[model samples]
Target chain A: MAELTDTAQQRATGLLRDYGAAVRAKRIRAAMYFVALVICVLAASWSGEVDLRKFVEGLPRFGSYFRDITPTLRPATLGSDIAEWYWNFPVWLELLLETLLVAYVGTLAGATLGFFLCFFTSANISGNRTVSFVVKRALEFCRTVPDIVFALLFVFAIGLGPVPGVLAIAIHTAGALGKQFAEVIENIDLKPVEGLRSTGANWVDQIQFAVLPQVTSNFASYVLLRFEINVRGATVMGFVGAGGIGKELLGSIRQFYYSDVSAILLMIIATVVVIDLLTERLRHRLLGTAKV
Target chain B: MKPRIAEPCDIDRLRTAYPSAFAPGYARRAAALAGISAVVGLFIFGVVWLGFSPSALVQGISKLGVILKLMFPPTAGQHMLVYLQALAQTLSIALLGTMLAALVAFPLSFLAARNVVGRWLLRFLTKRVFDAIRGIDTLVWALIFINVVGLGPFAGILAVAMSDVGAFGKLFSEAIETASPKPVEGVLSTGASKIQEVRFAIVPQVLPLLLSQVLYYFESNIRSATVIGIVGAGGIGLYLSNEIGQQSWDHVSFIILMILITVAIIDAVSGRLRRSIIGAQARS
Candidate 1:
């Protein structure tokens, strides 16, 4: 009995020691992480000139800017106040329409290009490994460079117009959508594809008969999502003189037309909300029907 | 919408039972045709309205080619130091901005999460607020901040932080909502208070996922920081815009190359960090 108790006590002590070592190691790691985080924060704040005092001082100005942008209204002249707030309603509407059209055209063109490119990029269908690898990298380059930067480049090359805006959005959209489409294609069940191949169907026929049916609805949904993003992008394309409501917004901002700035922002926000709702509904409908 | 069972050797019965399968209805066919026509019509109309002609495209491509040629020999000109410093500043902006946003968002996300916040109206309001703020792009925020706080990287930081607050809030709340209830129950069984339960249970469960998300956002915000600089909020983007204006294609290419490299490096590093965090969590 004495020998057995000694062995049990020794085992208990060993287990406790191991536990203590594990916990101490964990604490050290945590401490190191904390130190590293503090260092990064201090260095970043210093380099970025993140002065809390300056921000606090400017806080009032930020508040007042918001205040100034809010359109004043009284019960007596509400209609006139509203009308005056949106004084350039017609021109703004025209520009807004152009922005929508730019998004539409950009999305369509991008989706079409992405549709073709995705097949070549997808690992399952890519006939040539080198081509797939190159296409993937190109898509990454396109998406990594912000659409606005692309607009800046296009605006430089093509001159100021909606065309540059369209091209910029299209290129970015293709990159973004192509990756998504390729992923969808890669995830597809390959049994049908194999069956088609075994039946002596050519590559094109296999894709058409087996792959397209599985991925069309998904592709459409992705295209709609891209369109929503591109609309927001197109709104800002005008800042670079690529043509859109953004040009007007930028002008008002630079000239300090506070009311006009607020008015245009509201219109843009409303348009985005509406488009979001509409596209969401369309996507649901498409996916739901596809399932049925 | 139920599938119809057709009697074998009864073609007439099958046709009557599933008429739409044999021949689409007039209304359906017309609607389909109209949809196709509308799409084609809009494409043509957009082509004309946007002046997207083949001739113009060919001309623009040649101009782009010329610009590309100018960009081939990438050089930083005389302002290499300035460009490098600006690059560092961009990274700082993204890092600081993301940290600040995550700090601000941590508490707010609990208020937005359904499992944490019992009140439906509060959750709804919080979500809508997030949506509204997120709807405004980071550059727009940068422009506004420049007006309010004056030009420089400070504005860029504030703008990035402000925009990311919305995104982080939404994402963090979703992460919180998905945390398992078992942990909360276990914590409660120990007679822990509400705050204690959350601190000891929910947070631990969700922290790894949230950190991974924050890391991902940090990587993307670096990209955004570069763009926001073009609006004069401060960073290498300011350098880029200046060079572009001066028609210094080589310098512009160099700055762009720097951005791409920085972004790629950060992406790889952050991805590793996120994987490690997730792996540690799984092991635990």
Candidate 2:
């Protein structure tokens, strides 16, 4: 300690002082943030009319919903006869299957349309910036307007049914997937596109021979992801008279049929889980093959 | 990335070089074509199944044109202030719900993390719980909550929070699992308790990423709150749906404008914040 240089010791104290100041500043900032957040929370609780007392009282009511939702399993009927637990299981399954098909058709149509539009939107691909901007904005508008809203409009125009639901889901999907697919296109290795173009290839040939190969796997992955989301969207589109199990679910809720509500919800949850699993596997397979 | 055809080769030369391929010898191409045709066929079937009528579409468009003409001179009508209030409520619902989700999920995220949770079974169960929660859409949750709480923004808030709990739990836990252990180990080496190590090391590392994700969701939830409102939960969406039903095209257009503006503003603000957060992380 005696051998330490005077400047070195001075430097050490200065560093310590700076560190203390920084820590103090950070603490002050953190405290202010906490206070601000608390105030915001309190204000929102009031504005949103969140009554903690009422919530606590209604907590059991919420719990009862889940209890009702759970299938009853008597000892005698445990696995051998599950009728009472799910009386409308077969009909609900068909409606749920219809829901799945709606999502599938919507996703397929949307992704294909998006595939064409994304090229025009991608900065790296489009030749005309004005066209690109318009296309991008159109896609944004398509997505920004909720599928339910679109469903409502179409229901008004074309009458209430599955067509409106499918159209709504498709437009929403195109809006979302076009943006994502464009990003994928922009991120691709430009060397291939440049190579193809230098070889006297037209735009179509370049996209087909070079760009498509690079992006098809990713495009497929995004489409699958969109399909998963569309399933959820299609479920709710029925609230606006668009067709699917959502129509029945809404009807059940409207009529206060607690048993049917639970039954329909169970089927929806099951369908979502199964679709997620199936799509996850498909994405993995596509990516795995692409990698190889 | 493999080039499908050798570059610098003429189209004619390529065709001559691969005559059999030109006649559809490539299984991949044939399969792709088949898939495309099938998709097109399915689209046609879906249209037919929908009982699509061109005449109806044309009639609908003309009706829509009348609405659009009325909508041109957009007026807020007598409910301008009411519309504004509803919009604010939607924003609040989104904000409050997102924060609530973050608060609930923060601690549970640790339990869900594979690195933090000791037992594989516990982690697996936690993950599945998150998945199940996330499986039910916010609109469904909104409908369910409306049943319990009656109706209003309260239901919307709860719906958003519940769905976000599932999402944030999964995302936050995954972020925690991906965090490097060196800093945690360093903190522990100073005789710190497990809690102290986590508080000092892990939280600092993952908080930014978690918050950015939460922020992004907050923006999207604004749109969701509106959608859920259509189900009678509460928000401007209820008003929008009402106007649409009554064929008050002007009010509907006004509501649409407000929502679009609100969403655009939120998207821009959140985008900047996300960038700044990423920049800070990069610098540090």
Model 2 clashing residue pairs (backbone): none
Candidate 1 wrongly placed segments (more than 4 Å): A1-23, A290-292, B1-34, B189-191
iRMS values for every prediction = 1.2, 1.6
lDDT (Cα, tens digit) per residue for candidate 1, span B1-284:
75476556688888898887888578987998998799879977987887787888888899999999999799987888998889989999999899989999999999999888899999999988887777777888889999988999999999999989999999999999999999999999999998998899899999999999999999999989998888899888888888888889999899889998999999999999999999999999
Q: For residues B111-214, could you state the per-residue lDDT of candidate 2 as single tens digits?
A: 89976778998888988899989988898899888877878988889899999999999999999999999998899899998789789989999988987999
Q: Can you give the TM-score per candidate against the true fold?
A: 0.91, 0.92
Query: Per-residue alpha-carbon lDDT of model 1 for A65-93, expressed as tens digits?
Result: 99988888778999999999989999999
Could you give the DockQ of candidate 2?
0.56
Question: How high is the TM-score of chain B in model 2?
Answer: 0.87
Give the Cα lDDT of each candidate. Answer: 0.91, 0.87
Q: Model 1 chain A — which ten-residue stretch has the worst lDDT?
A: A228-237
Model 1 steric clash pairs? none
